[model samples]
Target: VVGAVVSITGVSSTVTSFGTTVRSDLVLQNENHMFLDISLWSDIARNLNGQELAVLGRSGPVMLAVCSLRVTGATKGGYSLTSTPGTRCVLNPVSEMAHLVQS
Candidate 1:
């Protein structure tokens, strides 16, 4: 799903999914405010800020296109993984993804 990263805490990264936009508790933060102690993807053991990413879930149709992520220090509730800086990934809508692929 295509959306923006509203907030990033020690545990979870909140994304606002596009279309119909059903608000899920999975949303740690949004265009508005931040929520603490939310669960996050195990693979996301690092901080992502001002970066866009296409996260492929291990299972289910839950794919997150995240951007504007800010990494905070480790918290007791946060995922237990090392945080390393990396190049940001850009997330585009399906149409945009297809266009880029075709180009």
Candidate 2:
């Protein structure tokens, strides 16, 4: 999905039986005003956090394209997207759809 990043939480660690998983939460809003909360994992999460801060400092919205996410019900209610190992995230992507989302 393509949207402007509304907010990004700081990176944190979760200790699971499998090991330690680093994660961050990013909230995005599309042109239609729909909101999506995406859980970015590992390196992607940390990188996106830095990008969000940098772009926001310049007073520009952070445009993001997140793909290959797994849709699941959110614990509080509706639905949310989770990044898998295969998920891809691009910041300020150059594309027709991304342009539309920006405008």
Candidate 3:
């Protein structure tokens, strides 16, 4: 899915039986104004913390192209998207769809 970045939450950590788990919520909105929350896990979440994220959207709403996502039921209701190991994200993608979303 390709959408405009609305906001990204600060990285949060949780302790599980495996070990410490890190995640961040990246909220994106499509041209139709529908919102989707994608959970970015591990290194992907850590890399966007603090200043890095600000830089990404400093110019304008960051355009994102996300692939290989997993659909899961949200806690409150409905469904939310989650990043899988194969998930790939591209910022400011130079495509017609991205341009439409940007405008």
Candidate 4:
């Protein structure tokens, strides 16, 4: 699917005033109108929109869209993060890692 991230689910809201553990499930589709499923954590809270993500199934490659997002699930107290967020925190935009190969 080439469509954008139409929805996000499974986020815990019962966190402390400070950050807490959580998980986010996403929905993606494309021009062909196929749906893809993805999950991410709160760490990417700031910079994940409009980024390109790819996955392969029995078919060919597909792109995941991430537009508007909704945080779901309930929070109670600090527990070990079920699924770790993409990044607990953001890294330097121009860090030396940019020179490293990715994918």
Candidate 5:
């Protein structure tokens, strides 16, 4: 499905992967009509928001996909897939990624 850019938001972090924890805010966003939201790490936060992003999610029998997004806020919303909001990087499915790039 195709969705327009909506908004990007920032969020706070309490720990890092290396165990060297630090508190920081990162940017995230919701795509067009998707119930899920996307967030980027501090290193890429600035470049992520308000940018068109392609996303994909999968389970045993369910698959979710989205294209184009607008990062919006700083607070964590209910749409996150990770335990910590805006901390983990979301991966787009390879098939969806190929579809997105080809279009």
Candidate 6:
């Protein structure tokens, strides 16, 4: 897994799997131009305000922008979070698995 200290840009936007328009989370680059997109499978993210975090990635990480999260006061299993940049993101790891999990 690739580990890096990235600034938590914010929680992700709501995306419909339908149609041709693709959607994902947004994280700003450490230097210049554009955002990096990352896919979050669970309701495991939220918005951050210019907070930097140490993160270890999982699966096939994206190259466009960063992360996402389920919103506060949002209904269960519902995606209604607005794009909140500079939001902080938290990363967690499961304790059950062993070295069997790797990139």
* Tens digit per residue, CA lDDT, model 5, 28-96: 333543443433344444333333233222221112222222333334563423334423233333444
Residue 59 lDDT in candidate 1: 20
Which segments of candidate 5 are over 4 A away from where they belong? 12-14, 17-35, 39-42, 46-98, 101-103
TM-score of 5: 0.26
Kindly report which residue stretches of model 2 are placed more than 4 angstroms away from their true locations once superposed.
6-21, 50-85, 89-103
Give per-residue CA lDDT, model 1, range 1-103, as digits (tens).
2223344333233434463322221324333232322233323423432222223321222333322333333446854222223323222234435443232
Decoy 3 TM-score against native: 0.43
Poorly placed runs, candidate 4 (over 4 Å):
1-21, 45-103
> Which structure among the candidates has the greatest lDDT?
3
lDDT of 4: 0.33
lDDT of 3 by residue, 8-62 (tens): 4443333233665555555544343445455555565646553465467445545
Residue 82 accuracy (lDDT) in model 6: 41
**What's the ranking of the predictions by TM-score, best on top?**
3, 2, 4, 6, 5, 1
Q: How big is the positional error of residue 58 in model 5, measured in Å on the Cα after superposition?
A: 27
Choose the strongest candidate by TM-score. Answer: 3
Report, for all candidates in order, the number of backbone clashes. Answer: 2, 0, 0, 9, 10, 19
Local error of candidate 4 at residue 18 (angstroms): 10
What TM-scores do the predictions have?
Answer: 0.23, 0.40, 0.43, 0.28, 0.26, 0.27
Pitting candidate 3 against candidate 4, the one with the higher TM-score is: 3
Model 6 lDDT per residue over 30-73, tens place: 22222334444223333322242324333323221233333322
Angstrom error of the Cα, residue 14, model 3: value is 5.8
Ranking by lDDT: 3, 2, 6, 5, 4, 1
lDDT (10s digit) by residue, model 2, range 1-103: 4344443333333323355445555554444344445565556654656455546634643444443344333345666555545444443345644544433
Candidate 1's TM-score reads: 0.23
